[model samples]
Target: MSCQHEESMHLESISQSSTDHSLVVPQCPDDLFVVSQAVKRVKEFYAKHGEIKESHGWNHIQAVCDHTRKALLALDYTIQDNVVVEIQLAALLHDLDDKKYFPNTPPGEYPNASAILKEFGISPEGSRKNSYEKIILMISWVGCSENGNTVPKQVKDTDAYHLLIPRWADRLEAVGSRGVVRCYQYNQEKGLPISSPASPRPQNEEELWAKYATSDKLQEYMDRGGTSKDMISHYYDKLLHIARPPKDIVRNSYLEHQAESSSKDLVEVCLRYGKSGQVDKEYIMSLS
Candidate 1:
């Protein structure tokens, strides 16, 4: 099937599914000349990067745009010309850095992808920068693989909630430390505030024990337990596992040691910041 056809099918399935929040198709305004131009630029940008055979290729951008639009619709967002344009821009540009700089590596070790977007005038400082910065920052937060970066409580909570509800929590968790840390850092950079008390400082082995001991946390959050701590814990554990490497690799040689080590380290950083009370719970939970 054609890529467009496949995209349409995916969108239709998303729209028809009762689990997804309802969405309204947006109408383009007659005077949206600038938006049209932005879309054109975005198309060109994707075309250029699409040649790479990796996750950040052209079709990936298209898929993200489709998913993003549906996500916005589910939230009852208006998807105005500018919002649509920004979403497209953010989706396309989000992984530019990863594609160009870290294609072979996990997304955690790479620097901010927004720097390039900003240089190209596609970011907050550009002409139509309304929510552009926030959007980019949100994408960055969700995309990052490191910790110590603080995210607004709301964004953190929203994202965490989405992770659990849609069963993407495991994937998000699987991103391990690097992903969670980056997400937290993005949230903090945006000045998003924390809604709850900071988690206590996790001691030496406490971090590891807390994770295995609280595996139930995952189930609790999935089952709609009151607080977001469980989700946070689950994410933390996943990140930790990714960042650290197992000692008995020879016995389990199939494991990607480097990737596993990176993942564990990434989660460790997230735990540090989270215990320091830097991450925003509400924001992570609010993701659609």
Candidate 2:
């Protein structure tokens, strides 16, 4: 089949399989084929394994993919089709083996992504496969702001921009208006509070993880029968502190501004609500 015809068919298949229609297939035939296959596999995997998570659902995947593409476009360097494919696949399957969803499965194996690539007939020993694994694993480690500051030595030594493109895109998703909603959804699912004025907030990533990372520690908070660290405090402790990209990297200024403004506005409303027991009407209007 002609590449155009194949692209059209894949686009139709993707649309039928997913509610999301925003996926833009790459023009390169090989890239298009791989990415289309990856999208279908991801949908099936998520549906079968975990259905969809509250914050890290299919929607989140789509958003990250979109951000990754845009980030690549904004780059000062030229991106190759193979590199784009690797980055896109990394975005698609970044959370495939997440410990949160598939606890105790294994570490650093990327079994799900590996399986999908195997189905695509990619060689296990190929450099492409190696790059895919590295990028996806790096993305998995790029958590909220507190932890994101520490890039693993191996990742820093690789093609830094290739990995950083997806890492920054994923991190960018954790702030802004979309981010606020995700935080609320996650906290609500966990039965955590919106705010806890009496409790002290975590000072850094270590303390943050110690208090809420493990099942045992999370249960400890649950057993307390009250809010220790509220969902809104998530912004104060982490989201608000998201690092700006260095001068060398082409920053997504629009996203940065939205994150800053939206997060600050949200914290302001939450603080006022705590004291006055009412939503901020003016803030609501400003959003409109």
Per lDDT, the best of the predicted structures is 2
lDDT by residue for model 1 (216-255), tens: 4334443552224433444443334323333322112212
**Model 1 residue 18 lDDT?**
39
By summed lDDT, the worst window of 10 consecutive residues in model 2 runs over 212-221
Reference-based TM-score of each model:
0.37, 0.69
Clashes of each: 51, 0
What is candidate 1's local distance difference test score?
Answer: 0.41
lDDT of each: 0.41, 0.58
Off by over 4 Å in 2: 1-22, 25-27, 145-147, 152-159, 199-228, 243-266, 273-288
